[model samples]
Target chain A: MNIPSKLIEDAVTEISRLPGIGKKTALRLALHLLKQNEVHTEALTLALTRMRQEVQYCKKCHNISDGEICQICASMRRDKTVICVVEDIRDVLAIENTNQYQGTYHVLGGVISPIQGIGPEELTIESLLERVSLSQEDEEEPIQEIILALSATMEGDTTSFYLAKRLKEKGIKVSTIARGIPVGGELEYTDEVTLGRSIMTRINYSTE
Target chain B: MNIPSKLIEDAVTEISRLPGIGKKTALRLALHLLKQNEVHTEALTLALTRMRQEVQYCKKCHNISDGEICQICASMRRDKTVICVVEDIRDVLAIENTNQYQGTYHVLGGVISPIQGIGPEELTIESLLERVSLSQEDEEEPIQEIILALSATMEGDTTSFYLAKRLKEKGIKVSTIARGIPVGGELEYTDEVTLGRSIMTRINYSTE
Candidate 1:
């Protein structure tokens, strides 16, 4: 596109650096910002800058936080003995939104993917292993379970297997979330692997 | 979504304020930024802030510029006699990208839309009229034609009609861009209004 001003062009280039945003969308966004109140743009930039510079990563779960530890990990009511292992903070938020899990989370950063040159070391796997091992000696609240809540992808499975092997010596229960067709999912569109797994892991029908 | 960090939530809220962006996309963008190098975030914010704070509106045509006069208006090679009147800077950029028009532009900011409480008074129509009237007295390069390159929407047509009536008194020739099927538009799916207009405005074909 033939941008009239160098300043607008620079802004568009920067905005388009984000994933999913194209040059056209970036230009539209830039123009929208220009048309809006100056304070609106100022607030947006301020928020983004503060988020990038001041946001903290939890020391325990590695989830993003405002301080040294995330709220989920610091909460007293949460199940301290259980840890939900997932790919990243997004998964943590997704599970939290479900309102089903009362346990804490251990964000792995990402699943082990050799093709992308992402191994166990690249993720937070080492810290998870250390946490699990150290929890065994904690007399007050020893960790009882480590739930492998990672995705059902090949990389996720590989990471789960590796974690299970490491946590086996710790004597903590290692389990995984159930894999099945989603609540509103139609059987006709369901993939064979998931369908087969759902059937294999079917529970008893009790019409309560 | 359950965002763990307050800073991330703030950033997401601000990012979602842009047109077409939703809360989910905003969170995804925020997380993507968090994963990227800090310098990238800094560059994006700095560019946006600079664009918002330093960008100038051209005094002559109301198009955004880096100086008092836009590059197009200041260019010696551009035609001073013909002015392409458009709704906004985006239209100007679109026309410039075609590399066909050599005339300068007059940006109206927006078209007349009573539904949105926007009228000729809200736009730069008065300034455009002033520019055209003043050009007639100029000894050199007096403006001769005012081409209306507005959209085919109802508001666009209303704005064009208003301008045409106003410019008629000044004795300047007023013309509009052709209304027809786009280069790759399919007649089967084309709307009746556009297809009818295309037939009505058909130009004679001459073999080269």
Candidate 2:
């Protein structure tokens, strides 16, 4: 495009660097910003810069926080005995939205992906182990279980398998979230892998 | 979503305000920025703020520019007697990409859309008339033609119609870009309106 102004081109280039945004979308966004009030643009810039500069990660759970430890890990009401392991902060947010789980979370940051050169060591796996061992040594209500709540992908499975092996040696029970046909899903439209897994893991029907 | 950090939530809210972006996509983008280098985030923020704070518009044609007059309007080689009226700077960029036109441009800023509460008074129509009248009084090469290069939408047609009526009173030729099947397009799937218009506006074939 024959951009008339250097500033517009610069802004477009910077915006297009974002993951899903392309040059045309970036141009549209830049033009939109130009047409809007300066206060709106300033607010967006301030929020992005401030978040990047001031954001902190929880020392215990590795989740995003405003201080050394996150609110979830610091809350006394949360069940410290059970740790729901997740791949990133988004997972933490997703699970928290359900309001079903009462346990604390251990954010691994990412799962084990060989193609991306990310392994167990690259994640917060070591810290998780240390947290478990330290809690056990303290003799306080020892951690009873670790829930592997990672994604249903190869990387997630590999990470879960490695952590289960290590946690078993430490005498801690490890569990995984159930995988089956999603609620409201039609079996005919379901992929074979998921349908097969759902049937294989089907539980006995019972009534009180 | 149960966002853990206020900073993350703030950034997501701000980013999602852009056109076409949703809350989930904003969250993803915000987290992506969190994981990236501080330099990348800083560059994005700086560019947006700088563009909003320092960008200027051309006084003659209202095109985005770094100076009082835009580069195209300031260039002496461009045809001064012909003006292509467009809706916005993006239209100017689109036409410039074609590299077929050497005339100048007049950015109307927007089209007439009563549904959106936008009218000709909201655009730069008055200034366009003033420019033409001023050129005519100066006895210089007066504007010989005004090409209506707005979009094919109803609002664009309304704005063009309004401008054409006014320009005709000034005795200047008014024209619009052709409406027909696009170049290299197949007729089998072409829309009936465009195909019919193409046939009705067909020109005589001649060879020298």
Candidate 3:
């Protein structure tokens, strides 16, 4: 893009490395930082650096934390026996925002993607198993259910299948989130696969 | 959106400060950085900080530069007597990319916008006038023309009009880029204001 300065070009190159940001957008962002006060730029850089260097992974769930354990893992109000497994930290935040699930979360860090050269070993699958086994050994409020709340993708399914097999041997219940058309989705626009799955797994209409 | 970690939330807040980025996208980006190798995040932060702190503005034209003078302003091949004035650095980059304009540039930093509390004093207008006067005093390659290449907005027009009035006294030609339907733009979909202006400023057609 014929950047005028080496500094701006260097900044743009690094910013464009991020997911979803293109070269043009990177240039815009870099120019924005240039226009802003130096303190603002320093603050942004400091925050990102601290987050990268200081942010810890919950040994039990692998969720991002400021300390040894995540807030959710340390909270007494949450259902420690029920763990919702997710592929990414963003997924954990998404579920937390819904406020429907009161259980703890186990961030898989990533799903099993063979095409991306990612295997089960590369993820936090072993930590999850260790968490469950540790709880069982303690015999105090042992993990009763593990909810596979991963995405509706091939990688998600493969990871869930693999985890379910292992968790079943440990005598713990392993289940998956339901797949259906979204609540506000129209029947006409619904994809055939989702519609078919909804029909096959339809629940009986009984008011409690 | 119920971020899991204070460090993550801080990073997300800073990242979301960028234009066009929202809270959700910020969280996603933060999580992405967390998953990536630490070196990548450090590189991004270092580049941005260095760019913000080290980038210099050309004293002659106010364009971003690594040294005292920008590459365009310092190059002897560029027509220094003919200057194209623009509102921002991105505009300078845009004109440079066009490969049509051989003249040097004068970056006004921003257009006059009363609503935003930005006036002539807030821009590089005084410096531009000073530059023209300095060249006139030298009596060598006096500026023959000053092109107002600002955006076709009310503020851009106001700034151009203000500059034109003062520049006319110096006996130098003042011109603005033509405002009309964009290249390949459909006449049917063109707005009335632009169509009317185009018709009023229409020139004789001839193969030059």
Candidate 4:
């Protein structure tokens, strides 16, 4: 009844459930799918099924993993005593792509958002504290540092503040990732890279 | 090391194989599918698998069907003596949606395109002629009409001309679906209601 076949229209309906796809674009996608062979469709289905089935969160640090522990968590070559906490798995991947952080990661799943009913209970913060404290029981040396790798959004700042207060009570060194202009989110709209350097130079958080 | 997760990147690669989907939009689609629960993913996979596995073209008309005979071919109410030849299965469904004709269809798979290397042998032209001849053998009334429902493109016009010549040799009255403007493609963005009226007033094609 629509611009294309019933099969095409049905495919469009399924695709339209995505976050930003509209009906017209959905139709375009569906028509495209129809033209492809079974191999292509099978590959897509397999990827989706694998993403759901293979990927899970690390129990110790909460980073995304194909196993119980993520690559970073299992790697003895990295600095296990330094943990970088982030708001989501996406942030972890973004940080990992930079190949700079030798420390492991903790993914909070989401920021604390009162409107969306997300709170401390909904996050992996408790597990993080437990992991940091696990150092005392195992003779692996106390967690020397914690890096707050949350976004620079309002919620991210609030979450970092909450995390900082809690970690300070337990007597661990804590620091936040700098609030400099993001690699892509903007910089001369922020020559703020220079301004950020000034802030880092003037930093006065406890170094322990 | 790409802009998105590896699993997401893999899914996008698969989805981009569809007819018109590009890499950017496919990435968005893959991300959307990942965000959904197991049930949504499972449903989509099932639909995709069924589309490839369960669907087959009808022996009689070439329209997509779950059985040897398409739904239209199996329907007793349809007039067997009038066969509307269409460019593809999509066109058959589009006409069926109109509910204007009681006749069955014969899908040509595609129009004659020398540029694309599609010729009469590549189509269902032989099968169509055999079907007409078989009707005569079965003591059924001779096939009275053959309608060419194709797009108003150059290839469509050429195909219609060739098909009309073939059917007229067999003594069947052949016609084309009216073309003043498309129902949706644009007559300054046509309404289907106006398009329907124009179909009723269509002029006949002359060999002259």
Candidate 5:
């Protein structure tokens, strides 16, 4: 039998569904919300509600947005020719947080994983191709680059290879970001300076 | 200047307003949501909205509920004569997780903290007293017992003392849970078995 009230139990169940939050953590968060003043709890509830109502996918690049187009796609300052393709919007935020990338992003939504039943058609690959075809104004210039900034997992590799082949057929220069230890994730498995240097002197992927 | 889109920034800002979440963690959670499927995202958002719209405080016990009375207050199996007084609904969950307590709960909403300007008047103390006065039956068996299961903190102690005095005039038996060292909070400062022994040989407080 359930020990907590149905309301509390529902909140805990929802919280536990989040990544990294276990049953104990969910209970803690639920209880904390309960202790808060009605106004405070109301604000949290409103934010959660509005996050759904307001947020949407950018029509152009498939990145997260509050409108028709993502900020990156809408911005005139970003390099339109150099599109960094990633697995999800989290990668968009990760690159954005680095303050190192100036190109716009294309969120693939997820990687192509046969094991997971995710194929090329399942992603926004068609939209990406359509966006790449938008070079009609300057056909001679061609798209300068398509950077594959996908994660360094097996699925990410397979997806990158698939994307590279598809983009290469359209005569676009496709390049995968170097595979190395992540800044986060598991760290004790890797030595410190080696991981940092791997990031510094990364190699490009090539069929040769 | 804000680093991300205004709506995304605003969402993160609002999420960080919760008790333990910081800006970094809020960003992580927001990015995680942005990466999730729209259906999953909508579920979380809806849960938050429903929490505010549907959930209410139990008029009788001050505990959280989706109706006028919480399920604990509504349950027939729970012992109504015995009340377990706690600092918050979180404490209620903690006790409930043990599966040892069969009595219903009364959430204080918070402990007494002079520094934070929180006192007896700010809590559900008056409601608790009213509950006691009205609960007495024709048989005159008295409201058997009240368990003061507040935390072992200084503020918790102060609140228990204040509550004990208030209940004593009504001729109700008030008891407090024992305290010495916590189960896991800063264990390096405590001896091994003392904490274990404290849990084994708990003494009841006699509010005479």
Candidate 6:
């Protein structure tokens, strides 16, 4: 694309550097910005720059936060004894939206993926272990359960297995979220591996 | 949807204001930027801000440019006697990519769309007429042809019809690009209107 203006070309180049946006989409976005009010463009630029400059990671859970500790970790009502481990902040947001879980979260930042050269040490695993150990010092209510709520991928499974092995030595109960056919899913459409797991882990149904 | 950090939330809100970007995609983009190097985010913000602030419009052709006059209008190699009138800069770029058209262009900025509350007065149509009338004053090489190269949409058709009526009174040759089944398009799947037009405007074939 022979873009006429140097400014437009530079903007399009920068925008196309994003993950899923291509040159065409970037051009469209640049044009759209051109058509919008100048204040809108200023707000977008300011928000992005401020977010990058001022954003902080929670010291306790390693999730994104504006301060030292995240809101979820600082909240007294949340069940700190049962920490739900997630791969990233997006999962925390997803689970938080459900509003079913009352426990806090430990964002791993990412799962263990040897292909990406990311290992257990690169993540927040060490800090999580430290948190668990510190909880043991509190004799009143020690850490009881650690829920592994990572994705259902190979990297997720490997990280779960590694964490479970480490947590078991500290006498902490380790559990994983159940995997099966999703609610309202048809049996015939479910994949074979999930269907087999669902059948093997089938629980006794009751109308109570 | 429950973003933990205020910075992330703000960034998502601004990013989602862009055309075709939803809240989920905005969140993903914000997180992606968070994961990237700080310099990348800075560069993106700077590029967007500078582009919006410093960009200028061409005086002669109404196309986007870094200077007063666009490159095509300022170049001596381009034919000044023929002007291809387009709806926007994107169409100018598209035509330039073909490398076939040697004439300059007049970018109308947009078509006449009553539904969108856009009229001829809102576009650069008056400036185009002024250019043609000025060319008549030159006396040596006046604008010989005006190509109505707008899109095939109803708005484009209305604008083209209006321009052709106005330009014909000035005794300048007016033409439009032909529409037919696209090259490599299957005849059976082509729409009725286009297929009928293609047959009505069929040209003679010769072995020479």
lDDT of 4 by residue, B1-208 (tens): 3532456556667767765678766765665565557778787777666665555678988776667887788898999889999987667767878879899999888889999999999989899988887886776656778888887788998999998898788887888876666544766577675577678876668832
> Can you list the residue pairs that collide in candidate 6?
none
For model 1, what is the error of residue A34's alpha carbon versus the real structure, in angstroms, after optimal superposition? 1.2
Tell me the spans in candidate 2 whose CA falls farther than 4 Å from its real position.
Answer: A204-208, B138-140, B184-208
Ranking by TM-score: 3, 6, 1, 2, 5, 4
lDDT winner, 1 or 3: 1
Instruction: Tell me candidate 1's TM-score on chain B.
Output: 0.93
Candidate 5: segments with Cα more than 4 A from true spot: A1-4, A31-50, A54-56, A66-69, A74-76, A133-137, A180-208, B1-4, B24-47, B54-60, B65-81, B97-99, B133-139, B180-208
Superposed Cα deviation of residue A195, candidate 3 (Å): 0.6
DockQ of 4: 0.24
Query: What is each candidate's DockQ, to 2 decimals?
Result: 0.85, 0.84, 0.88, 0.24, 0.34, 0.87
The alpha-carbon RMSD values of the candidates against the true structure, listed in the order shown, are 2.4, 2.4, 1.5, 7.1, 5.5, 2.2
Deviation of model 2 at B108, angstroms: 1.3
Each model's lDDT: 0.92, 0.93, 0.91, 0.75, 0.78, 0.93
lDDT of 1 by residue, B1-208 (tens): 8787899999999999999999999999999999989999999999999999999999989999999999988999999899999998889989999999999999998899999999889999999999988999997989999999999999999999999999999999999999988999899888999999999988888842
Question: What CAPRI-style quality would you assign to candidate 6?
Answer: high
Clashing pairs in 4: A32-B18, A32-B19, A32-B20, A33-B18, A33-B19, A187-A190
- Cα error, residue A154 of model 6, in Å, equals 2.0
Clashing residue pair totals per candidate (backbone < 3 A): 0, 0, 0, 6, 0, 0
Query: Model 6 chain B, poorest ten-residue lDDT window?
Result: B199-208
What is the TM-score of candidate 4? Answer: 0.65
Candidate 3 displacement at residue B115 in angstroms? 1.4
Q: Where does model 5 sit among the CAPRI classes? A: acceptable
What's the residue-level lDDT of A106 in candidate 2? 95
User: What is the per-residue lDDT of model 1 for residues A1-208, given as tens digits with 9 covering 90 to 100?
Assistant: 8788999999999999999999999999999999888999899999999999999999999999999988999999999999999998889989988889999999988889999999889999889888987887888888999999998999999998999998887778999999999999999899999999999988878952
Question: Weakest 10 consecutive residues, lDDT, candidate 3 chain B?
Answer: B199-208
In model 2, what is the error at residue B77, expressed in angstroms? 3.5
The superposed Cα distance between candidate 5 and the true structure at residue A4, in angstroms, equals: 5.5
- Weakest lDDT window of 10 consecutive positions for candidate 1 chain A: A199-208
Q: Per-residue alpha-carbon lDDT of model 6 for B78-164, expressed as tens digits? A: 999999999888999999999999999999989999999999899998899999999999988799999999988889999999999
Q: Residue-wise lDDT of candidate 5 within B39-155, one digit each (tens)?
A: 776666566556655667888788877678888889988888889999877777678889898888898989899999998899999999988988875354346799999977789
